[model samples]
Target: MLEVRCLLRSVRFCSSAPFPRHKPSAKLSVRDALGAQNTSGERIKVQGWIRSVRSQKEVLFLHVNDGSSLESLQIVADSSLDSRELTFGSSVEIQGQLVKSPSKRQNVELKAEKIKIIGNCDAKAFPIKYKERHPLEYLRQYPHFRCRTNVLGSILRIRSEATAAIHSFFKDSGFVHIHTPIITSNDSEGAGELFQLEPSGKLKVPEENFFNVPAFLTVSGQLHLEVMSGAFTQVFTFGPTFRAENSQSRRHLAEFYMVEAEISFVNSLQDLMQVIEELFKATAMMVLSNCPEDVELCHKFIAPGQKVISFVDKAQYICCLIISYTEAVEILKQASQNFTFTPEWGVNLQTEHEKYLVKHCGNIPVFIINYPLAIKPFYMRDNEDGPQHTVAAVDLLVPGVGELFGGGLREERYHFLEERLARSGLTEVYQWYLDLRRFGSVPHGGFGMGFERYLQCILGVDNIKDVIPFPRFPHSCLL
Candidate 1:
């Protein structure tokens, strides 16, 4: 009876030994599996859209992409497992053993054990056909599906990395991120190109409007950042800004993202310029280091074989040239190149003038500082230069993108700002802005950067629309 009891106990122990601990589902991203060191012989599940497929009697090959990386993960399947639904653009869930790939394109591939099509795409009717490169302009027509193409995918990935890099730069340097309001009563740029906000349909009286007085989509977040800068010392904001300029040029957009920063107690314009230069260099280096493949893909598709210098290398070697606006006008006027707009002393620098200036400075970023007060907005500090009558303003001109950044020392004097506001007929509208000076004002300054333009500059993309996911221009608001 004791021996029988022992035998029963042994049986019970053996039955409860865990049974190899099978998982419900072991899904791995193509990116993680490809970069995994010891994933060979491991049963892993992958889900992605098929990029291409080649079926044969003995073995079949499938190229799948999950938008995690530039390269597609190759999947090797047996002919018996092949199905008619394994077509291009079809989304599938694959369970397979990871194995070493013999192909030179990738290091590891999946040997499929089971395949299930989650969604089958109709290849015949799909807008993005297989194995054909679509032009950027043609892709813009299908904004909804443009992301499936390799070019757009690459551009977006780089854009995300660039954004993260910018935030990382600021965070590392102890700058606080501020979210400025999208709708406000004051026009930040004072350019009078605001998109006015109103009640639904129509309203009988202005007081019956949503925000009471005139509210508009903000042109810039500079004022809000300045408000935050008073408390945080260093504050920055990244958000959508709107303008109703009605410009159809390649460089104009009705809506875009802006990166604005404000620093308190900044003594001179050089301090602001240093921040801009360092921010650009740091962010460019971070992106180049993290997303070299994406950047390379952009260059390959956008400007084939252009032989442009790497972003990191350019940032390291190219010393940013700081020239006064008066000096820039002199240089542009003396240049042999013909320009559509003549570079006058007080005129704002046109695209042609900016391009000429950058080229004249040996294809490096040029900073034109101390712009004429008459041309700049009212917030720029008035430089006490007698004859020139300039403001402490600056514009950072890059090689491909004419103007990547623009800013200056803000006019923090209460009386000066009040007079300027009254002269611009905006004193009542910006009474709160003047209050910042009245309470506790210090010598502060900042700059604003167009996020899309920065992407175009870094990637060497010619068209602004291609860089931005959804190009918002006049009368062209497509999904």
Candidate 2:
């Protein structure tokens, strides 16, 4: 359902046939055929699966859908064309006359002249039946066929538009897209929750360890993007990240996509926060404009009476709330809501704390900055503030989702990085990273946004698996 057109943008197809041939009839997409204004019936060909079919004494009606659009094209034909192969979930090539529809529901409909059954589907065996709104859990069982549903079709199109919008945002902002490596030697997160790779049925000494040293699926693209930040002033990478945590929480995923960016010459957290705020606003607005109808359909079926887009628009209008992590802890302590974990000055913020902070900040996205140094990773820039020590880190928490983005000013000082890595026993391992600080290192910072969480936040989807196709989690990996 996600066309992934950007992947093919650089590929140019050249067909130089020696002899010219007659042009075939124009084949139109469901979106195209629906938007036609031709009152003077023009012949058009549409190929897609049948969404619904109705047989009457003298007339027949069918709704055909292709992934191009969320709405299906209404087809009206004579009852004489009705056949057993014309059941729901069957693939067909429909040649029809496109004419303006008298119904207010849509602008145009098709009057079928010829119906060719390309593939016949047995309705009884098909998991997805006609006119039944299956819950997301049920649809998830049929991972291979769930995309055919209008709900998933809408979600994927939104995802595609969002991906395109994010790419455009970086391009317009003078940020180079870097394709970071999927396998890395270093654990950027320092969490030790990594998926290590080893060859199957291995025995030889050299082949025992594939890379001689263990390799892991990358947990973050921040380190790789930082390398590019040295050359390119602004660089970004949007790709899959892996974590070996066994959490079955709605937010946790074994494999997911991340949108990470690094900016050079950032003197303060204010500069980094500005970029994060703008990225969210710009991407949201662009996706809304690109796929409004598809988004609306998701709001209708998924959230049911929830104004997902309006809430996103409201967040854009109001300024994102900014507060120190100390302020956040104080706010949590003062609140009446009982938290599962106590909110202390140095402890990490739990989901409950994050949600409460967002609500307390007038229901807008809130940025909590300057986390405790001991709790944060080694890469964060040290505050060097005596008495109460912290790092120049920031986390953006939204209403429904906790910690939408996490970033900080990277430790650009050579001595600080060396000492930290030495303490962690990784000095020789990260010689290349140390080399960056040795020569002309600028004060740079970056943040990574969870792509799936962003989709769930915008679409009001309850589960992370619903938004992404072939979701990889602790115990779930469906084809």
Candidate 3:
């Protein structure tokens, strides 16, 4: 039971009443009041964009979707009526009684007696259609309009539900919602490449004294959030986090949303991974239960659409489960035929290895913990006994996507923190972060899970661009 209050921030909604309305009986989404006992005599109004309009010999069926469910309402309108006037992308409201029909196995459907077109999309101009098969790459190009399609619409909705579930899980578990600044002066992650904004309308060169000092877009919010954790006890921030990495891989994005949470008085890396695991379990259950329609939509469109023709009806395409990096490598050694990249200890798992591990070895999400320090960021706590260069970090990977999450227990000692920063050549800039340790910082750990990546995983969408209504990638920037 998901209750969503439509606070349309980025979406543009039609105002000033697109059409005359009859008495508004509490409007219900297709999934919500669909199969209720009161559905027999219930007079309800439902509004959504038309998914498809089909006319039979004497009856017309307009499959309408509100981004609520993959199963569209089979609106049985009279053939004498004008359904040709309706079009895709048209916002409509239908008032009717809910009834079970034998034509389909659907539990419930709207027996529409009155249909009103609030807004109509021109069929010729609308890029999406019921019959045509569009490429995923082509759909990525049109991020904003992609959601109008049933598959993309369900993806966006599932993404929304997952996002809400994250906040709910944390909020319920005593995590304070902290709003970390987007424009910051520090690159705490020590990732060299970043986007820097200047006052003079040019890329600020550090040597030229632009803006007097170089200030780049923030790569991570962990360091600043650490400062807040001392007072808040448990704090988390969810917002757009930027990284200027120029990698054009399908996994990396220039700008994305991160859910960064830091807790005070934590002891070890084990504590951090436990929290991450719980978060993953809660989120997965929420999606599986609440977003059943969206999940089915993913099965129909993204998985079985064309590329996944063989495993359309199969019980499993890619297996999902939790495993360590060492375990992942061991599993990879046995399943050589399925993967192109061979996984090895101390080496970062490629997207292909992640896909194979989940597809064949593990039938669920995999958590690869205790990564090599040389590969991990400078702030991760080091493991001196096992390997000097290895650190205590964990990355959550799924079948369709790689590196959905990256988090670890932060190095708490002042000297070790200073040593790592100095070795990485970031000492001068990160002195303030070390000051947190000097004053009253306790052993703390946190992780950053990109909101878009979670969205892609939940919806089973291949590309991150489709999940976000307005995506800011390396190439495209449009509202």
Better of 1 and 3 by TM-score: 1
Ranking the candidates on TM-score from highest down gives: 1, 2, 3
Model 1, span 1-479: residue lDDT tens: 99999999999999987777654447888788898787558888989999998998989999988988888889999988746888899999998888888878889999988888999999888999999999998899999988988889888988999899999999998899998999988777878998888767555465576766778999998988988877889999898999999888777799999999999999898898989999999988888888888888887878776544464457966679999888888988898888888778888889989988888888889998999999888899999799888999999999888999999999999998898989988898788989999888899999999999988888888888888888899899997
What TM-score should be assigned to candidate 2? 0.93
What value does the lDDT take at residue 33 in candidate 1? 83
**lDDT score at residue 384, model 2, on the 0-100 scale:** 96
Candidate 2 has which clashing residue pairs, if any? none
Q: What TM-score does structure 3 among the candidates reach?
A: 0.79
Best-performing candidate as measured by lDDT: 2
Worst 10 residues of 3 by lDDT: 307-316
lDDT of 3 by residue, 338-413 (tens): 5565567777788788777666643456677777788788778877755435677878775577677788878888
Question: Can you list the residue pairs that collide in candidate 1?
Answer: none
What TM-score would every model get versus the actual structure?
0.94, 0.93, 0.79
Ranking by lDDT: 2, 1, 3
Best by TM-score: 1
Query: In order, what is each prediction's RMSD in angstroms?
Result: 5.0, 6.5, 8.2
